[model samples]
Target: MWDLLDPYSYEFFVKGVVAATLAGALCGLVGVFIVLRGMSYIGHGLSHAIFGGFAACSVVGANYYVGAGAWGLGSALAINAISRSRRIGADAAIGVVTTASFALGVAMISIWGSRGASFDAALFGSILGISPTDLWVLTGVTVFTVGVVVLRYRALLFTTFDPEVAGASGVKVARTDALLMLVLSLSILTTLNVIGVTLVAATLVIPAVVARMLTNSFAHMLVLSTAIGATCGFVGMNLSYHLDVPSGTTIVLTGAAVFLLVLAGTGGRRLSRTARSAPAPVRPEETVSLP
Candidate 1:
């Protein structure tokens, strides 16, 4: 028990736990919308796209969050813009813009050769190294995201389910999309340190997907997903401390495990329901002749 509780005594571990919790909650909340909107790929794309700004900030000795947030917002808007074109599909736009941005980041890194920063940490994360400032930023972003979702709940729902109907009903579909994208960009920035650029998308996607599998109501899904994400963060951090593994990977794997469990449970229930509803076969002797 003492050994298990020992890691919590350290300030860094505490900070990492707080950071992971906040990041997980924010990702889970925003991810509900992402899954509903069929924009899961955008999360992965934006995570990569922000790497260019991260690399640039490293080269110039600027605040990483500010630089990355700005870059991510820009990429989000660019994706939105490209998706507006009749010639381009939304997924195609996301792929094109984010891939280009990721390539730019890679090129910058290759040219700069780390500049005393660890690319491995940036890509895979180092939760124990989370700074106080980063934690505050995560808090702010989480609060802002929740506020936006609460304030614009109806509008967001309308836009997500039926943009044409939402527009007809006086909802600003385009503006709502932009606002959602902004929130998504911020959410990605918040998770960059906790889950890193590569695995952040998993945090955004897995919990929401698991929640979706378990619930049909959107509000219930949001609550369940957020709870699942927070649980994963707390448990994964503890597991990481005990096992001496990467915190981010542990967190993501924990979520993955939950998803698998839910999948299996739900599938079993569905099969059971099907078996009960199936028609009984008639015996040859029981068959009747038609007149």
Candidate 2:
């Protein structure tokens, strides 16, 4: 027990733990909406799309988050705009725009290779390298996300689940959607330093999926997903330290393991319920033929 707790005495480990937990909670919270809206692909797409901004920022010597946020928000709005055409599906729009953005980022990196800029930190993350500034940014973003969700709970919920009905009920579905996208973009930006762009989507998705499998209640799902995400962060950080592996990969794998466990547990329960509710086979007398 002392051995396990010993890591907490180190400042870097402590920062990593705090950063991971906050990132997990934020991702879990916003992820509920992403999963519920059938927009899981957007999480992956937007993360990749931000790489273009990251590369551009590196070339220009600007703040990485600002560039990435601008790119992410722009890509998200573009996806929304393309998806609104009705001729294209949301997933298709996301795929088209995000892939192009990612390709552009790659090209920029290739062109700027002589500048000595490295994207490894953005691509794979360095959780132990988290700074005080990063923590402050994470805290602010997390608070903003939670506040928006709490204040506009009903409006966001109605719009997400039933856009037509919500619009008819005077819910301003378009504005709500834009706001959600903005929040999602910010959320993705926050996780870039903790999990990197490659694994950030997994952080945004897996915990929410696990919670969804365990409950039908939306409110309960949010709480459960947040808890599961925080747990994964805490446990995965420790595991990475002990195992000398990548923190981002370990955290994502932790969430995946939890998802599988919850899936199997829920599946077993469903099967049991089916078996219990099934009607017994009828005898010949009970199965009279129709006239």
Candidate 3:
């Protein structure tokens, strides 16, 4: 295995591994909140919205990262505002913004294809082509995301578990929710750059789902999810290299498989425990009543 993964033989593989590790760590950390709040869709929505920004950047020959990041941030803020208003529910608001943003992005791409810049790579990621500047941006995003999650840990947890009680206790549930949105935005942007606009949602949800099955504690789930994501990245990259497959598709599939395995194992264990703990049925004639 060591010989097969010798970094000296292939430097690009090493870069891919590092990028995956950081991206996975960020996803796992922020994804815990996503799972708790049942807002995984928000991550998916933000990623789709980024395509508009990327299209705009390509049209003007501007920096793609700047365009994507700015547009993703704008979408996040819009979702937050719409959710706060009584006019629409959270999921509904997300649906509206994400759908419109994605459609607009597609339109922008069509209009700007007349100029230069390829859309396929941005739509699906270019891991092997990640530049040094992109690596630096990825590193910064990871750090900022992890730091925000850590700092707001208690408030976020309180809000997630018992929003009404936490709010009464001065937890500021709305602020925490928005803060999570911000962290998720950062995670989405980084993952999009690493994996591409189309599949970044997997990084935000798959590992977290797998970890939930393997562990009950939030902290443990986060750690396990990060490990699962990192493993998938490295393994998938090698498989793609050997088989001449797309790395992003392989990695996403690897994540899906891991989630299924974890789910099966967890379900099996619970079923066994349920069977053991079940009480025997009483005879029809036998009746008991408490005084």
Candidate 4:
């Protein structure tokens, strides 16, 4: 047992575990809205878009968080703006913008030799390299995300399920969407170091998907998803140390395993139609706030 748990003796391992845990929970928290809104692609797209910014920041000698954070926020807003247009679908907008940003990053890597961003580490993640500042920032982002969700619960739920009614109910649908995008962009930025650019979406998606399998209520799904994400992070970090695999890969694999187990155990019966990813109708009369 001492040998099995030997990695915990190191301080870096402890910090990495904590950072991954927070990132996982944070991703799960915002992922629900993303999923319910059929915006899961945004998580994948924004992370890639931010990678482009990360590469640019490295070239310009800017701080990763500041430059990449702003870039991601801009990309997210752009996606929202483009998607708002009637002609362009949200998926199309995400594809065009994020793919272009990713391609730019690739081109820069080809031209500038990956600069300071370290392509491999950025793509696959470098959990062990998490600094104290990054951990603190992740913690702050988590708290901020929770506050946003709590404060904007009614608005978020209403906008997520029925934007037409949400707007009618004085929820400010457009503003709510932009704010959720802001929080999502921030979550992806902070989690990038822990889960890497490539697998960050999986972290965002898997926990929420699993939670949905277990519950029908949006409120319950949110809480269960957060717990699953944190558990995956904690377990996956431990598995990464023992198996000598990438932390992001291990974390995603952990979630995937849970997803499979749940699917098998429940035999697809646990998921009610209402609990599925498609937004269930929320009539004005049923818009009473949930605790």
Best by TM-score: 4
The lDDT per prediction is 0.79, 0.79, 0.69, 0.84
Backbone clashes, each candidate: 0, 0, 0, 0
Residue 281 CA displacement from its true place in model 2, Å: 38
Pairs that collide in candidate 4 are none
Cα lDDT tens digits for candidate 4, 1-291: 897789888988999999989998999889888877767787888889988998887777778889899999999898877767788687887898898998898787778765465677678877666889989999999999999999888778888877876787677888998999899999998987788899999999889888877776788989999999999999998888898888899999999999999989987766453244435556544533222
Per-residue lDDT of model 1, residues 1-291, tens digit only? 788889889999999998888888888889887876667788889889988888898777778778888988998888767766688688887887888888888888788765634677678777655889888988998999889988988787766666776687677888999999999998887777778888889999888888777765667878888998899888887787788877789899999899888878888553232112112322222322111
Q: Which candidate model has the greater TM-score, 1 or 4? A: 4
In model 3, the clashing pairs are none
Of the pair 2 and 4, which is ahead by TM-score?
4
Q: TM-score for all predictions?
A: 0.88, 0.88, 0.84, 0.93
Greater lDDT among 2 and 4 belongs to 4
Question: On residues 1-291, what C-alpha lDDT tens digit does candidate 3 reach at each position?
Answer: 785656437777777767766776777677766765666777788888877777777777787767677787788888767766786688887887798888887887676562434566556655565666667887998888767767776776666656666778777888887777777777777666456767878877788777766655656766787788778876766666666566667778778888777667678553232112112322223331111
Please give the lDDT score at residue 20 for candidate 1: 85
- The segments of candidate 1 whose C-alpha lies over 4 angstroms from its true place after superposition are 114-117, 268-291
lDDT winner among the candidates? 4
